[model samples]
Target: MKVTVFYSSDATKSAAFDVQPSDTVKSVKQKVIALHSPPDWANTALLAEKDSTEYFDNRKRLAQCGVVDGAVLKFTYARNLTLMEKVELNVQGTDTGNFQLPPMSISTLPPKVAAY
Candidate 1:
C-alpha cells in the first residue's frame, strides 16, 4: 500500500511510502511523524481524505476506510491562532502597495482578554 503524507507548514510537501495492506491510518501517521519530525507547535493531527471526501478517524472501524494503492493521505498543520488575531493579518499583493482584505468581524470579547 502506497501512502502519501502531506506536511503543511510555511509551505506544503508530499511524501510517499509503501506500507502493508493491513496498515491503519494511525500506523501511517506514526510513520509520517517519524519521517518528518514536527515542531512542538504542530501536534500530529491528520485530515485523511480521498477524492475530496474526508475519512472519519473512527479508531474502532479502521478497515471501513479502504486503503488501496494510490490513495492520497494529506497531513495538515493547524494554525493555533484566535479568530480575531487571524482577521488582523495584513495581506500584500505582488506589487508594493496593493493590499486587499475582507471586512473584519468585530469580537465581543474585551481587549483585556488575551489572544494567543
Candidate 2:
C-alpha cells in the first residue's frame, strides 16, 4: 500500500511512501525524516485522513489504524528554537500582556579603545 505524508501547514512539504499493511507509524516517520524533514522526527505527529484532530499511534500497524493506500497523512513537527527565541520564552509574563519579541540577527562595529 502507498501512503502520502505532508506537513499540515504546508502541503508542498511532503513525501510519498510505499508501505506494507504491517508497517508501523514509527517506521513511516523514520523514512519521512530521512528523506527531507527536520531532525526532530520523534516529535512529528501523524494525522489521519478522516479526522485532522486525531493522531495515529506509532505502535499501531497501518491496517489496524485503518490507513489505506492513497490515504493522505498530514504530519507536523516542532521547530528548533534560536537563541533569541529561547530568550523570549524565558521572559516572565505579567498583567501588562505578554512580553513578546521577534527573533533578530545582530552585527557590531569595531571599538576604538584608544584613538589618537
Candidate 3:
C-alpha cells in the first residue's frame, strides 16, 4: 500500500507523499526528516489525510486510519518562519495587531529546517 504525507509551516503549506502502508506517521516522519535533513531550529508540523479531509493526531493511528495503497498523505509545519519573515514579525514597531502576511508559496521541496 502506498500512502502520501503532507506538511507545512503556516497551515496553508502542504506536501504530498507516496509511501508504504506499513509506515506509521512517526516512521514516515523519520524518513522525511532523513530525506530532508532540515536545520535544528526549524518548526515542522506533520499531518495525515484520507481522501479530502485532514487527520488529527489525537484520535487516529497512521496505520489504522486505513492508509491503504495509493493513499495521499499530507503533512505541514505552519510556524516555521524564514529569517526574513521572522525578523519582520519580531520588529518592535511592527503593527502586529493588524499585521497580515502574504500567502506563502507552497512547494514540493523539503523543509530546510525541521520545526518540531
Q: Model 2 over residues 10-83: C-alpha lDDT tens digits?
A: 55776788999899888887787676556443444455653376778889888988888898887766554554
Q: Which is the winner by lDDT between candidate 2 and candidate 3? A: 2
lDDT of 3 by residue, 57-110 (tens): 534455676666666666544455565565487685654344445566877888
Residue 99, candidate 1: how far off, in angstroms? 36
Question: Per-residue CA lDDT of candidate 1, range 1-116, in tens?
Answer: 56666665533577888877666667777777787777778644565763444744726233467666776767664455444444454322223323444455676776685779
RMSD values, in order shown: 10.0, 10.5, 15.9
Off by over 4 Å in 2: 39-47, 79-116
**How close to the true structure is residue 15 of candidate 3, measured as C-alpha lDDT?**
43
Task: Give the number of colliding residue pairs in candidate 2.
Answer: 0
List runs of model 3 lying over 4 Å from the truth: 6-22, 39-41, 50-53, 56-60, 80-116
Ranking by lDDT: 2, 1, 3
TM-score of each: 0.52, 0.57, 0.43
Clashes of each: 0, 0, 19
On lDDT, the stronger of 1 and 2 is 2
Error of 1 at 80 (Å): 9.0
User: What is candidate 2's local distance difference test score?
Assistant: 0.69
Instruction: Write down the worst ten-residue block by lDDT for model 3.
Output: 6-15
